[model samples]
Target: MAVVPVRLLLLIVGVVAQYVGITPPNVHPPNEQLREQRGLERSLDLVLVTLRILLWSWAFIEGSILFALSGYCPPAFARPFLHLPTNLTSDPTELTPAFLTGIVLTLAGALLRVSCYRALGKHFTFQLSIRPTHALVTDGVYGIIRHPSYTGFMMHTVGYLFCVLDRQGPIVSVCTGLLDGSGTGHTTVTRVWACVWATGLYLIYALMFGRMNKEDEMLQKNIGEEWRAWVKRVPYRLLPGVY
Candidate 1:
């Protein structure tokens, strides 16, 4: 069997980290409740999930781009579209600093996020909705930061972007190709696709931060003194030292 290239391996790992979700799917908040109170959040999450899936799909295209650049070229049909500038100049098998950094971030984020999910147990949900008999968790990762999961997710997202949108990646290639001839293909298609990616990222950041505040307020309202005490003890929402 042919050994998979390090770049390919990193891409695969990043994709896995990107798609991993909370265990016991029932942990999701009640849609009716979320829609009733934080309708914007509920709507944003729908956009978030769709864009995320599209981002995941890009990994396959990135792999195809890499394979075309390597000695092992893809089939004749794909060769036309795989003409990314990096393909000719860069070695897909070589691991770049950006790629390595991205993989590390993705894995670290995934691990932290997963730990948070486990720590929260049945309390964790994709949306902000306090379940019946909901209790605040102040142990494990939650003790260090009130929103460690968000931090993990942000790290994972930024890292994955670094990895997949590097010079060798397809999106960058197209963006670069727009200015430089030897880059990727298409003009209108590339710009639109790039914009969609950008919008998705923006939504993720904006919505997550908003949701964090909403969560804090909700917790304070519901849990009262215990929530306030936990905040004082933790002192930070997402980061340990930084806000």
Candidate 2:
């Protein structure tokens, strides 16, 4: 318990480090030019979209700190009617299994994203907008899938959620013996918060999926039958067997 705050601080630092480590400072344009380009509506500017995702990410982290550290929640907010567990602390052993797993997954995901960066070189942009001189990248890991970069980002998000859920919710307490747990993930209030949080995450995921489709459409249009042939060979978008 005494070290919990320190651990929490480290967790935040780790999150920032993940961003700093993976994203190349030079890759994204100084000013994205995504207005009404590549099938995207003018309203859906790349800057706006990036800002939206950043806001969501910040909210998720803040929510985790509140719900996990002190069980704080919104004013005038009501708990859910259904029952769930909420009083779980991160395990205190040298390395709790769930915590260890979370760290490993996060690190691995970071590596994957960095690999994607190296593979794409300057071709990678923060937005769906493609450069006129961009070549249809197919060799290397790109041949394995349509979007390794997205897969990397998805993996990082999943790992983050897993760590937060296991350490901060009662559903995972039994595995680590951190609390009484009540055999549930969260109490009504926490569940409600979680649902709201999950909904926000789902929206981001849907947005990313949309970006993937839009990018694919753009590629097929630009690259022609060669792109379609590569798609037939690769087949999967984010996952191997499942979507």
Candidate 3:
């Protein structure tokens, strides 16, 4: 029987521990008080809150399953540094300044996401179809970014890249890094796959935005010229000066 090296054994154990929620030293829960304070306290309000949580949970579970099945992990050295538990045995070179930057970006994105969730208040729902209670929230963070959720999402993606900057980032990262650096003839088929996934994400966002825009139009018709004036004031839709 072929024997697994101690280092590989340890790395596998660490990965398993992470998946089981063993509470890595670098992982910390977001502000609990702030999370609780933002939403409505009523029982009915739980519906929207539950839906929101479930949607994110689904995404995480799906991604994890897909990655595991594909047997792909990215190289952390070429990109970001991840502040993972020191107890985990792996490549020391994974820790770098770039990884730290990724961590900071990720945290900032998480905070923005939480802020957007708070801003949504009772209107937050998981279904692709807009709920009746949904309203065009143009105040708070929404005032600055038309789709604060998307901003939060972008930040979250950056954070994810940072967190996984080790041997577990993404399969595509590993494939590309190997091909680019080692001059190996290995082809990265996942590049196109990643692009497709990205396009899907963008399409989902676009659909959500379209729904919101339609809702906003209805709101404008109902509320009159007030919304139009606000739209004029907030010129940018997603990114500033771009689109």
Candidate 4:
């Protein structure tokens, strides 16, 4: 039977997970608390938010085009892009290690994020701000990692990258064009894109580190000993075994 490319399917699932985890009820900080954020913190928040929007928009558009091209008969609108690679469906039993890993991580991250939402309730916000009734949450996924949501976010980002990198699709094609203007599949372009993506991943980790520290400081000040004790009990921030 035919199916949408696994990577494309993964992309759709991941995006939906993000939307579900973040959209409803807003659950954001009040205007006063939001304004209290440090300049650098606010800048970082905006940058990350903007980056996600651009990246997800790009991924969805690219994935859609690739999906259309993957059909046994390419859509008339997609025919102009016929020069692109078109391996859409694959045997489930023969899935690549990277693809399987992406699927696992994406789902795991989504679940983790949802758990965090439940644990934090109204306290959760995309911004780093403490609400009037903000209380340090220690149960649920938080018991494992202080910043389970960040871990989830990292996992989702990395998983999506893995899914895209596992095969030649729009990312490869576009990066190739950007690298050498040939739009032809060039090995050098592939390697360059990998390096670029790795750099972006590092930036994400760095961003998370900053945000985590800021959050810890905010909570430590607001909640005092209780927050410190919870951190001591949990120990880890993003990863369980490592830091």
Report, for every candidate in turn, its global Cα lDDT versus the true structure: 0.70, 0.58, 0.45, 0.67
| TM-score of decoy 4 | 0.77
Ranking by lDDT: 1, 4, 2, 3
Count of clashing residue pairs in every prediction: 0, 3, 2, 0
Model 4 Cα shift for residue 111 (angstroms): 1.8
TM-score of each: 0.80, 0.64, 0.47, 0.77
lDDT string for model 2 (97-166, tens) is 5544655666677777777777777777666666667788787767777888778777766665655555
Off by over 4 Å in 3: 1-93, 96-102, 127-137, 158-193
Q: Which is superior by TM-score, 1 or 2? A: 1
Worst 10 residues of 2 by lDDT: 76-85
Question: Per-residue alpha-carbon lDDT of model 1 for 48-159, expressed as tens digits?
Answer: 5675667667887777765655556657845775554443333444576877888888889989989987887777777667777688999998899999988988888778
Q: Residue-wise lDDT of candidate 4 within 85-172, one digit each (tens)?
A: 3332322213457756766777788788888878878777777776788777888888888999888877876776666565444555
Q: List ranges where model 4 is wrong by over 4 Å.
A: 1-7, 18-27, 72-75, 85-95, 173-186
lDDT of 3 by residue, 1-243 (tens): 011132233333323322222112222233431122221222323533443453355335434423332324355431232322223222333333544554555556656666765776544433222344546777887787566665655664544444443333333344445445542322343455445446644644554565556556555766567767767877776676776
The parts of candidate 1 lying over 4 Å away from their true place are 1-4, 21-27, 31-35, 68-89, 174-179, 182-196
Clashing pairs in 1: none
As for TM-score, the candidate ahead, 2 or 3, is: 2
